[model samples]
Target: MSHTFRRRFAALVLALSLLTLPARALTAQEAGQLLQDYYIDDVSQEVLAQPTIDAMLSALGDHYTTYFTADEYAAFLASMEDVQLTGIGVKMQASENGPVVVEVLAGSPALEAGLQAGDLITAVDGVSTAGLEMGAVSALIQGQEGTQVTITYLRDGVSAACTLTRSSILVAATSAQLLEDHVGLLTCTTFGHDTYAHFTEALDQFPQADRWIVDLRDNGGGLTQAALDTLSVFTGGGIKCYFMDGSAQLSALEAKREQISSAPLIVLTDGGTASASEIFSAGIRDLKAGLVIGGRTYGKGVAQSVLDQYTNPELFDGDAMKITTVRFYTASGSTTDTVGVIPHLLVSPDLAQEVALLLSAAPPSGGTAGYYRLDLNGSWYISQKAALAQPEVFAQLLAAIPPTAALWQGSGDGWNSVQPQQAAADHSIPFQSRLFSDVEGSPYAQSIQRLAVYGVVLGNGQGSYFPKSSLTRAQLAALLAQALNCTVPTGESLFSDVSMDDSYGLAINAIAKMGLVEGVGNGLFRPDDTVTHEQFFTIMGRLAQRVSLTFQISRQGATQEDLDSDRLSRFAPWSRLSVWLLSSSQLDELDQPVSLLWDDVTRIDPTAPISREEAADLLCAVLERTGILPA
Candidate 1:
């Protein structure tokens, strides 16, 4: 047969084959089945029952898994390849006159048009380039490939003009240069198709450097295989990472390559570093191959598999599914999913490289820094400097510790763990316990006494604690203000019903300003209004958000679905998620016997008024759970 005729005949046969594909491969149903089979978490029956693919994916609650249209899939594929830019390629910088060409790329339209370095472009088309920023000039210069652009330039104070067609140019995925003290700074923008080769080439360009810093700041991820291959350059041939599938089965990804360099390594990351970038960082850290110095990375430990018509002709027509198949972990088996890879020395993103360079040269000296080593879920050595520098981070680490757990202190490798009470006793610290006579035999006695000691709850002047009385809105505000360290308002109250002379006025205004509460419509503070159980939980949830307090939801605790379908639904729409969060959190147990419905994670009377005793217990439980009040 003739070649053209054969090609047409082959296309016809393929079209016919697609028309006769099996019925089992139809759209939503088959895609749902595939999702259930491949998803990294258990797919609920409710999710699969959705009639359309979009609804199904949304119900699955896995944000990474997505459906992409044909055009979107094409763009995604292009992004995974080498970075491409379309322009009459010439690198330029801003100058007093106009953009001054620094270099003309070989094989580019600019070079072909005879544009040279030191030539300043005075205008584009007929528009003046004066006072336009470099970015503005670049936007004007870059356009659709094959489009024509005219530039007016001054060569040694003489005017000239050139018309050029824009074309696609491939930019290097990685670049490297040597810094002072034999330090190499290698920057990688993407884990694209050519990342491994480009990374190696960059490394090879600076082989004389003894220390290296791989900057992965603002790098979102690309191809997984490319990241693994690039990481192998440092770790050599071995198991680089582990992945856990839906069935909890673990698999290791190994690379069979020899180590490229044995020099000390440092990784720089920021909040934008995700997925493949995180994989590279985790591998280096887990292998003890490098020290990461930057803000916490964007936690994206899941891996996705793209399914398109090319991969499965029978299942897909033009649309595709980017399904999350597994959760990847470091070689040490820890995943950077929600909690990102913590840097060895955390610093601001701009300062991270500077700090890394300093540490690369020599260890930090000349500080009365003490280290607090704690073994919560993992081993961590927190320095006094780190704690003071990032107090919120230090508080979070401390919160991870069980309240009664001992903390260790010492310098370098020598350490001694000291219990809270023991350390206090050894230092002869004066510890006082407050007693309330009225609550001496009550179930909430201990909680009331504890809150009294923390100054969160008070008695009726004569030492008579009214534990069973209903908690008032004003009372609750004062209690929260004290616990949260909210400053007492100095100005006039915002509510018409409240006055500066009122006892709870300052606390009410302070919390209101902080958005913890709202006036009972029409400027009424309603200080005497009863605080309900649901309202209290909602406030606790809001408090958690205000402080950025993240909780580890207990698997055994109630889920949001359960709360929505149960009596808890009586809560306001804005309060449900918060109430669920508080109910599901693994909070410290209360000393007293008063049964708060939230403690059971079920059977809460949402509209019932909360009592003083229950309010105190709940508040104290939150404080202890967040490490605000020691056990």
Candidate 2:
């Protein structure tokens, strides 16, 4: 036979063998019976099956959707509940100048590593990112916490290398301040699980304030329950708010608790405050809780209930759609749906400086001014003063509010575990030679091990846990996903270069959805990219946002100082994220960056990819600092 004819014969035989195997594998009788049972009885079955099969096959033509399955559905739910994932902290868009950083979160590893707004990311790691789509480039930059990623980019005319350690990046939700004047300022980013708690905590400390200012600007809403809980504080046994289900009226808020405070209240709102934030604001305004301030609020009075099955069992998980089931109404039966609550005191961002002018003409005792000084003893001392005679200086001082609370002197001393070196000497244990034995007996070991067991750390990839390798972007993202028990997406690759088989593909997709990172261009995703120190800080900042959104405490009247500043630092980008979260209110103090203590970098290697060892150490450190890990 000719060679071509022989090859064709072999190919035919292979095709026949492939087709024949399935029948043999399933027993011909059983296969035939099953087919007959489902399809042979009716012509409709045969016709419908063909169309259904055709539709399924056509859907698979787009690789992105081909991978969807029952498992994928669960994974999608997990992503939404957590609301965010890990990656480098930078907002990117296809601008006229090409992909540009729109905003850089303050105190993120990105900022620490020297990546700035307007700096063009030309490459990720060593791969040229040219022509790659934004999402693909973002995938390259995100990863497990503590893993290192390298970024090569151009700033001005200079080429530079920045290594960033990805950490769990969270979007912030609530920010509060006891303004120098006795007015309490609170900003809610979103109405998530913890928002009410955060607000309560802020309020509890400032019960004596004369007036309160609630800032809900730029707050895109979240959980309905959160909004109800927030509104409950200011309302008496009155109709808190109502929801309209189609044409029927549904009472969403039946007064659960008696009103906590009825002090003169002022709510600041803007275009960014929508959904649950609007509901809460409108409830207060209608119930006579406070005065509404600032620009017009975003009109998102519709309520949505999300059912997600993939989230942690402790969270709301089920197959649920966030459909607009109800339209929110104020206590007075007025609809603030598309037409949001107009502020009783309309203060525009541009006119914010005129607050002094507005105040000067008002009553003098209505507002008070003060400065906070942290004593070496950990006690915060408030120095009362009259409102500043100079308007510009007062605004500058307010603008300089520390992004995070000052380190409490008592915190380090109270929670400090004996240093390993000191503990060894004090206990008469040998230091280096008996390291493992010492660790076994050390009280701090349990806390460290807990973090490790939680998948927050996996030692170094090698058998030895280096404990000091700098964290990289990829490593941090992985650890964060693990810590949150985030469901990562899997299937055909979304980027041109990233294969479906790549191990980190799911995580990359999760982070991309969270808006923590962005791509360079084209369809490439350089997963092996290293990150810079500044980028690491930005990732922490993003994590802070998630933390704030997920966890919140309520406070009564507004005060001049934040009580939870130290807690916010673990999520480093709290300052900027706080702004986005609380864009509605008059509290502008949180929009500024806070200064980090000089020694904050000792635990992190600023130049290298944050390694697994570093991630473990940092996780332990945070847990310890937060008192989650016992001393």
Candidate 3:
């Protein structure tokens, strides 16, 4: 049998096995044991000691780890495939008194029965839904096909009751259409069991299209295998993701099928794009198969292993647990866990598809008569006319795009490429200035601008640099990582207070791995605490040491009286050495102390917090002293 057929057959068999499995009751202890054995992290005995399975799972604080009863398991399994469930079909959310109807699907029984959005469902078959969970309310509404359900709802202060027959409704997991310019647009709402097949069907309908856009915005992920299979259709066989469990070993998830189309692919993403959706996005990017354009994706890098009676007949009868078993990474060993996959082109989610379409346009044949071809980081063919239509967004993109972005201009096959600024001046497109609006007057302005051009430092969104603010631990780590071009680690952090979810956790881990930083105590890296002058100097000293530079002054260079001065004594014994090193070290050509304290002075105060400007000066000084940065 074909690999695709084998995969589908396996999925079908798994679903069928779930239905035929014996309904046996599982003890809470068994559930806890299963979780302890297979969960991504080791569980403490205290957490597992919770009286019930639900309590144990909840205490872990892993929202993805869930225990499902037989009926719930059936629904869970069904949700992984195309939607075909017996329901009245009104999407609802829990409210104070009952569930509020949010949406009514077209041709659904609820819509036919005159239910509308904003209607509060008070009861289901005379049973009050007040304060019930959404799952409970849904369970009360869905039943066997042809079964009748009575729903009591309030519409604008008036109560009404309706009895409707539930029917099977099919919601397509994937939708396809040929868009303007022959670009095939495939929107996948989920990575379901049949999603790969649906994608292939979509591709078959648009064989003539040379470019395709896969829109994954707001697509909460589903089956991992489904996502891999669908990605295979575009990228052919390769490693889709890397999985690391409690074992701490990276394992590759390979796509085994040949590609269906060699057309240039573009992926659209948003903050709501997660999990299997992320898997597909990362695969497209890492495999060099497509370009991702949109907002940062929802960072969901962990995969859950669903265990049930069908798989472990001896342990579970009907109930099952979906436990987080591993953290997944990109094929390049980078993670989309807390640090989501940042798009190559970051546009508003609403405009992502439009921008992608613009990017997919071929370079003009007649050589740019009405159009100007632009290239940003190898992604090309954005036209000036189309860009000018969305001036505000184009300005935003121009700001984000590097200053090195090239532009082509001419007429009738005589196009000439020019610098971005030159092209912007010629075409009247606004460009971002390298200097911050507020930093031109700061003492460290020159250093900050240099770093900014190198992409080491960035201004706050409003274009101002908060130079007076004290630098926090997290911010320091991020700056150091960027300045050094450190490869941020994707594994679990060593510090207890930092998780993969923390914005700067990856940077912290990266610096920690380089032995330039450490936790304060008790395995806690106080990421929010401000960095003191002494602490900053110590880290700089470590950095200098790593690069084989010696900043420490010998006895001949500094007298015993100078070494024992109160200024040096104020610092901690362990920090005094680094402080002295920094105070004595001079810039190569300038012959000035590397340490820049308050008010641009060389004096060091061990206890005082370092301001943002001071930190920038200090970093530049260190880099210059060590020959890492041009003096």
Number of the predicted model whose lDDT against the real structure is largest: 3
The true-structure Cα RMSD of candidate 1 reads 15.1
TM-score of each: 0.49, 0.37, 0.63
Tens digit of per-residue lDDT, candidate 3, span 1-631: 1233223223322342445645776678987787766777888898789999878877887889988888887787776666777899776766677789966776899889999989999999999997788999889888999999999989889999999999997656676777664789887888887899989998887787888999999898988888998999988887777776666655678889889988888899998999989889877876777778887788777878776655666766667777787787766555666446666666678778777777777667756675656554354666677777776556555544433345676565666876545656665877765556777778887777655654557657566768889999999998888766665778788899998788898989998987889999999999999999889878977765554213322312645565566768777777765666666544435766544333322355678998888888777666545434322
Number of residue pairs clashing in candidate 2, backbone atoms closer than 3 angstroms, sequence gap of 3 or more or interchain: 117
Q: How well is each residue in 367-468 modelled by candidate 1, as lDDT tens digits?
A: 323655544323334455545454344433332233333477654556677643343344344422234668866676667766664445556756677888
State which candidate, 1 or 3, has the greater TM-score: 3
- Tens-digit lDDT string for candidate 2 (518-550): 454696656667754445445543443333211
Q: Which stretches of candidate 3 lie over 4 Å from their true place?
A: 1-22, 85-169, 376-379, 392-396, 409-461, 466-631
User: Is 1 or 3 the stronger prediction by lDDT?
Assistant: 3
Candidate 2 segments whose C-alpha is farther than 4 A from its true place: 1-84, 87-141, 149-164, 170-172, 175-186, 204-213, 246-252, 258-266, 304-318, 347-631
Per-candidate total of colliding backbone pairs: 0, 117, 0
Rank the candidate models, highest lDDT first.
3, 1, 2
Model 3 alpha-carbon miss at residue 57, Å? 1.2
Can you give the lDDT of residue 77 in candidate 1? 64
